[model samples]
Target: MRHLAFPLLFLAGCTRTADEPIDYDSLRAEACTSACAVIDTCDPDRFAGMDPEDCFERCSTLLPRLQEENQCGSREIIHLECLGKLTCDEFEQNEIGSDLSEPSSLDFDAPCVTELHWAVECDHKEPFNLDEPAPTAP
Candidate 1:
């Protein structure tokens, strides 16, 4: 996501000699910040081990509020919600890969959110079997 600090200062510091009255850039940045924060906290971990359909159902109920609050847009939230519904391996293979990275603010959108949601989701989903299958002794 575009950084906001510069734009925020530019907008808030409009001066008598300033040529630009309104800083759409800052406004957009603020909106993005709000959006990403909403996305970040909408942790798929909450629904770990849940059935896919159920996870989607729960996220569907909650995301509208995030949209209304200007935390995220309606367009892409569904994808993240859908991804949240997937199992860890399912999520990793289909939605993301292993080698997890800190999620970026840019992930508020569909594709990236889907990826990041699932990447983190896998970590929270469940641990793999550490023990080998027991051998059958004749």
Candidate 2:
């Protein structure tokens, strides 16, 4: 019975046999939409070579959503992917190029973060606790 107990416990822990599902298509669409909106706010001729702020603003508006949705990785992907869509040489030459690192933590409150979170992953069926702060249990 003792031998069986450990094996059963182990099996119980391993019962689930799959990774989390990601609605990649929806996320991509959201990101592209937000990017288009931001781009619309700027002058294309003025924005093409000099302004990375316009691009960053769009990313900021989108990335947070992606993190909250558990698609934090998608934030990075969107930034890199936008290079192909928008030909802002400054962003490629200075902004993301200078850093290959990631943000230290996810901040869901920000619009870009929120957008990014949703753009990268789906808010799984699990409930979210927006009112409660993260617990720091010892």
Candidate 3:
């Protein structure tokens, strides 16, 4: 009985603790930061023409989807950025020597926004672990 009791106590102590509660507000802010960084890295021209704060506000709708899709990490951001840069480069190459003025800014519901999200989703190389807790800000 004593031996069994000791082993049970040891096993109880070794049991994993409950996971920390997710702070969605923080996650949203982090996602916004990551999204902005991707835009800045991939398409500086877009970043220059757009207001970051406005962009954040506009992107709020995407935050939930991004979090659900597990597309909110440094690595994921870098991947999306690279894909975006390539897409922009291709677009520029095709438009070479064309007399095109910069178009007026559009909101998150714009076609370009959908295209960017699609590009990231399609180009992601790794699968995120859904079982793991969402990332928290430092």
Candidate 4:
């Protein structure tokens, strides 16, 4: 019985350590891909007449900045929020010179932006005291 108990405990300890370490580089690339997809879906008209290579180049330029600002290791929701804040002007300023002509319109009020703001402002509060029940409604 003692021998069996020791083996069982060792196996349990091994299982507890089985989760793989996060790969930040891969995560950053995935987040970048997701950000570009959101832009492509949400504002197709913006890229209508643009060259495919140019669009790819712009997105490539933005990916490193996004990775730097958002910390690719953070939760996916936070990454989405970072993406929501990204704008065409930001891309131009980072990639090209700030003196370039401005587009007539740029959308920064996507639904994800609102959700991100709400999460940051409201949902991220600390836990309640042990004696108090968490608020059921807000």
Candidate 5:
């Protein structure tokens, strides 16, 4: 009984606590991976000479900028969320990233993406918050 209690307590202690901040490193990595997977499948020819690796790396390198945009209350969270939910089917139906000839032109179009055409840049900023619910105390 004593040994059982010890293992159970150790496992519980290893779990995340409510006060901990969100790990943006892991969060961004996952988001980038997801978005890149969709692009690799649906828009393989998005660039003139780019492959899946190039696209994934490109998405990864934008993490810092994404974090900054989110911190600035650009609602980047929605963009990241939309990217994760992006499907090849949606890409085909909506003609997203469909234009392979114009590499320099903006062709990305998705319904889930919000404020993508905001004429103005994000100005006001707010405290960084990922908006996830706080974990309940054990």
Candidate 6:
């Protein structure tokens, strides 16, 4: 995540300038931080036996992918940030990371659930397991 420190400390002399452009990457990173913090603290029962470090590490790798839209910069930063602000109760209610297929009560609209981006997927001979090492690409 790009730190605001660079612009604030070095360029702006510890103050922010109006003309400074917002870095979307940094915004996405901050969103991940907020989300991760909430999960690490607010959802103990949900994440039982999980290390907070693992959550931070996994979230760092995964959350940034939300910005990779088909159109250049089409995905808005606000929507991504909205997801970061999701409540622990809401997350628990959603039953994410589970195999359950019940329709969600949460509004996945522009203000919050603006859009769902599909991950890059492919047909593999074997299902990848986290317990085991990744299969070698052909």
Evaluated at residue 4, the lDDT of candidate 4 is 5
Worst 10 residues of 2 by lDDT: 1-10
What is candidate 2's lDDT per residue for 74-108, written digit by digit as tens? 43334333422443442223233222134344444
lDDT of 3 at 17: 35
Tell me, by lDDT, which candidate is best: 5
- Best-to-worst ranking by lDDT: 5, 6, 2, 3, 4, 1
Off by over 4 Å in 4: 1-20, 47-57, 63-65, 69-77, 81-110, 114-138
lDDT of each: 0.31, 0.34, 0.34, 0.33, 0.41, 0.35
Which candidate, 3 or 5, would have the higher TM-score against the true structure? 5
Candidate 5 lDDT over residue span 15-115, tens digit each = 45558865656656665566556666777766435443376576556334455534432234434444445567864533443222343332434333222
Using Cα atoms with residue i matched to residue i, what is each candidate's TM-score against the true structure?
A: 0.23, 0.26, 0.32, 0.34, 0.54, 0.41
Give all candidate RMSDs, comma-separated: 19.0, 18.0, 19.3, 18.3, 15.0, 14.3
Between candidates 1 and 2, name the one with more favorable lDDT.
2
**Model 6 ranges off by over 4 Å:** 1-22, 45-53, 67-80, 96-138
Residue 32 in model 5: shift from native, Å? 0.4
Candidate 1 per-residue C-alpha lDDT over 75-137 given as tens digits, one digit per residue, 9 for 90 to 100: 223234334344444433433332224344223332334433432233222322111121221
Model 5 segments more than 4 A misplaced: 1-18, 48-53, 92-110, 115-124, 132-138
The worst-scoring run of ten residues by lDDT in candidate 4 lies at 1-10
Candidate number of the best TM-score? 5
Ranking by TM-score: 5, 6, 4, 3, 2, 1
- TM-score of structure candidate 6: 0.41
lDDT of 6 by residue, 98-130 (tens): 211322432333223322221122123332211
Worst 10 residues of 1 by lDDT: 1-10
